[model samples]
Target chain A: EPEVTQTPSHQVTQMGQEVILRCVPISNHLYFYWYRQILGQKVEFLVSFYNNEISEKSEIFDDQFSVERPDGSNFTLKIRSTKLEDSAMYFCASNQGHFGEAFFGQGTRLTVV
Target chain B: AQSVTQPDIHITVSEGASLELRCNYSYGATPYLFWYVQSPGQGLQLLLKYFSGDTLVQGIKGFEAEFKRSQSSFNLRKPSVHWSDAAEYFCAVGDGGGGADGLTFGKGTHLIIQP
Candidate 1:
């Protein structure tokens, strides 16, 4: 089965540093999303991308966060300034359509020190 | 706004015992419900989804869920859980707008299967 893949299984960055997390979604999927889960917390939606632009985003997706499809098959999330509270497991997901089954990546653990 | 509630923080069940994880969701219109499992150090794996079919939906790994609209719940059940069933189970609800939207996930219930 085709699956989404994320790079840098784990990352540790200093506070205020910029960090970029990369994901390669399933080839045929049309929608991509980024979600985060703080330790012992529920998974929270960050943003959703479609047609090369952001379709929807949550309040947590503030100015410090940006997502891009820098190139075909690559979706990236960049945190302009990482804060200690930014430490969490970030997951990338993709689905073929509105009602299609979504597949998630193993997740990139971001630890902001 | 959509939200999911998984009341149980942790549950321990002996091997070969039956298991049920409770999930309640708050959404308007008809909500699209889903159950996902995450093993240690792994991503969320979809167990099943309920769209507009029968209230009872069967999923992989011999797991099934019943969607009770009256109770606003979608509970996951496994007749016989194995040790490998130990993991975190999350219930999610999606917007029924037929647009590409993110899912609202519950806090998740940690399943501990004792051998």
Candidate 2:
């Protein structure tokens, strides 16, 4: 079965440095999302992208966070300046269309020190 | 606003015993319910979903859920659970608006199976 793939299973970055997380969603998927889960916390939605633009975002998705589908297949999330609280497991998900089941990637563990 | 509530933080069941994980939701409209399972250090996997039609919906891995409109609940159940069923189960509610809206997930319930 085709699945969403994320690169750099784990990453550690300096508190003020930048970090980029990459994901390659299923080829045919039309909707993509980024979610994060702090240790021992619930999964929280950060942002959703469709048609090469942000469709919706949560309060946690502030100006420091940005998502881009640079190429047709590659979706990337960039944090301009990482904070200690940014340490979490970041998940990438994609779906065929509206109300469709979203498939999740293994996740990228981001640890900012 | 849409929200999901999973009451149980953890549950233990012997192998071959029946299992049920409770879930409740607060949504204004008819909510789209889903159940997902995650093993240790893995991504979330969709077990089942309830959009419409039958109140009782069947899903993969011998799991099932009943959507009760009156109770605003969609609880996951299994007739006889196996050791492999040990994992974290999450209940989520979606807007069903057919867009890029994300699902609101509840705090998961950890299922422990004893052999």
Candidate 3:
């Protein structure tokens, strides 16, 4: 019953400020992903990471956003300049590999003021 | 391209009543379908998934889904629902077109259980 864990259950930041969200995926997982959910909207895929590089990303994942595995256990998402529209619940998910079950973290609520 | 559609935006059912949430998908090839539930202010929890094999798949919390290839639908159902089952349910489809990418989720359905 291993689970993905995200730090800073909630975050508040001013527009144009920098913010970083962290996630620790399951130890054996080989693929990691980041998704965002705006209030009352569908969960949208942001980015997917595998083999220490981005595998696939959506149009919403623009230059302003970047993801990195800073260390063995930490996968982080950095928003270079946050905008008010960036306010949403960001979820981190991981899967062992293709066709494997993906587990989601409790999510980090990012509130950009 | 892949997408998921959850027809009902919101549904209300009395306690101890049966429940069914509809989901449809648009994807080429044999797609991987999944159902997830999220409590208020929490992350998505995997209820069940269907890759291949039996069209009917049983999941945790007394939930099950049927995959209809002809209709391209994967509907979730529960014989009896409790107040605890009140949450947001999302239907997602993965790219079985051969890629290790993420899933495309539907807008989600908000379930309300009357006491």
Candidate 4:
């Protein structure tokens, strides 16, 4: 089955450094999303993208965070200045259409020191 | 706002025993409910989803869930569970559709299978 794929299975960066997490959604998918789960916490939605732009975002998706569909197949999340609290497992997902079943990537574990 | 609650933090069941995981949802309108399983250090794998129609929905791996509107609950059940079933299960709720459909997930229920 086709699946979403994320790069950098694990990443460790300094607290003040910038980091980029990349994802390649399913080819036919129209909607893409970014979610993060802190250790022992629930998965939280960060942002949703469609038509190459952000469609919705949560309060946790603040100024330090940004997402882009840099290419037709590549979706990325960039953190301008990572904080220690930013450490989490970040997952990328995509679906073909509205409310469709979404497939998730293995996730990128981002650890900020 | 939409939210999901998985009451049990952990559940232990013997292999070959029946299993059930509880989930409750809070949403203003018709909510899209989903069940996902996550093995340690793995990604979220969808088990099943309840959008509309029949309240009882069957999922992969012999798992099924019943959506009870009156109770605002969607509970997952399996007639027989295997040792591989040991994992963390999450219940999630989403909005109608489109790009606005960001899923709200519960804290998750960790399932432990006794051999």
Candidate 5:
């Protein structure tokens, strides 16, 4: 079965530095999303992208966060300034249509120091 | 607002034993419910979902869930579990009639399959 894929399985960055997490959603999927899981915490939704624009976002997705589908296949989340609290496992997901079941990627572990 | 609740934080059961994970939700309208599993260092994998139709929904890997509208719950159950079933399970709720922007997830219940 085709699945979502994320790059840089693990990353370490300094505080105040910029970081970009990349994801390649399933080729035929139309809705894409980003979620984060702090260590020992529940997964939290960050943002959702569809039709080349953001559909909705959570409070955690503040000014520092931005998502771009620079190309047809790649969905990228950039944090203008990384903070210690930003460290977590980021997962990318995609669904075929509205309210459809979603498939998720393995996730990228971001570590800020 | 939509929200999910998984009451048990962690549960341990011997291999071959039956298992059930409880989940409850708070939604003003009909809710789309889902169960997902995550192994250590891995991403979340959809276990099953309930939208409309039968109250009971079967899913991959020998798992199933019952949607009880009266109780506002969707609980996951398996007749028999294997050692590999050890993982963290999460329950999520979404607005059934609205767009996909309204999913809220519970913390999760860790399952430990003992040998």
Candidate 6:
């Protein structure tokens, strides 16, 4: 089965430094999303992208966070300045259409020190 | 606003025993309910979903859920669970409208299978 794939299974970055998380969603998927789970916390939705633009975002998705679909296959999330609280598991997900079952990537563990 | 509530933080069941995880939601309209499972250090996997039609829906890995409109709950259940069934289960609610709005997940319940 085709699945969303995320690169850099783990990443450790310095505070105030930039970090980019990459994801390649299933080829045919139309909607993409980025979610984060803090240690011992619930999964929180950060942003959702469709048609190469952000469709919706949560309060946690502030100005520091940005998402881009640089190419047909690559979807990337960039944090301009990392903070200690940014340490969490970041998940990428996609689905054929909106409100459908989303397939999630294994996840990228981002640790900011 | 849409929200999901999973009351139990953890549940321990013996192998071959029946299992049920409670989930309640607060949504204005008909909610899209889903159950997902995640093993330690892994991504979330969809177990089942309830969109419409039958109130009772069957999903993968011998899991099932009943959507009760009156109770505003979608509870996941299994007839006989195996040791491998031990994991974290999450109940989520989504906007029925076809928007990019993502899912709202509950805190999750950790399942421990005792031998």
Q: Each prediction's Cα RMSD?
A: 1.0, 1.0, 1.4, 1.0, 1.3, 1.1
Better of 2 and 3 by DockQ: 2
Tell me the TM-score of each prediction against the true structure. Answer: 0.98, 0.98, 0.97, 0.98, 0.96, 0.97
Lowest lDDT 10-residue stretch of candidate 2 chain B: B94-103
- Candidate 1 residues A11-41, lDDT tens each? 9999999999999999999999999999989
Q: Is the docking of candidate 1 incorrect, acceptable, medium or high quality?
A: medium
* Error at A14, model 2, angstroms: 1.3
Instruction: Give me the TM-scores of chain B across the candidates.
Output: 0.96, 0.97, 0.96, 0.96, 0.95, 0.97
TM-score of 4: 0.98
**For candidate 1, lDDT tens digit of each residue in B1-115?**
8889999999999999999999999998899999999999899999999999799999999999999999999999999999999999999999842247999999999999888
Which residue pairs show collisions in model 3? none
- For candidate 5, the TM-score is 0.96
Q: Pick the candidate with the highest lDDT.
A: 1
The window of 10 residues in a row where model 4 chain B has the poorest summed lDDT is B93-102
Task: Give per-residue CA lDDT, model 4, range B59-93, as digits (tens).
Answer: 99999999999999999999999999999999999
RMSD over all Cα atoms, model 3 = 1.4
Worst 10 residues of 1 chain A by lDDT: A94-103
Q: How many backbone clashes does candidate 4 have?
A: 0
lDDT score, candidate 5, position B59? 95
Q: Once model 1 is optimally superposed onto the true structure by TM-score, how far is the C-alpha of residue B105 displaced, in angstroms? A: 0.3
Across A2-49, the per-residue lDDT of candidate 2 in tens digits comes to: 999998899999999999999999999999999999988888889999
Chain A TM-score for candidate 4 is 0.98
Q: After superposing candidate 2, which stretches have Cα over 4 Å from the reference?
A: none
TM-score of 1: 0.98
State the C-alpha lDDT per candidate: 0.94, 0.93, 0.93, 0.93, 0.90, 0.93
Best model per DockQ:
2
DockQ score of each predicted structure, in the order shown: 0.68, 0.72, 0.62, 0.70, 0.56, 0.67
What is the lDDT for B105 in model 6? Answer: 92
| TM-score of the second chain of model 3 compared to its true counterpart | 0.96
> What TM value does the first chain of each candidate achieve?
0.99, 0.99, 0.99, 0.98, 0.98, 0.98
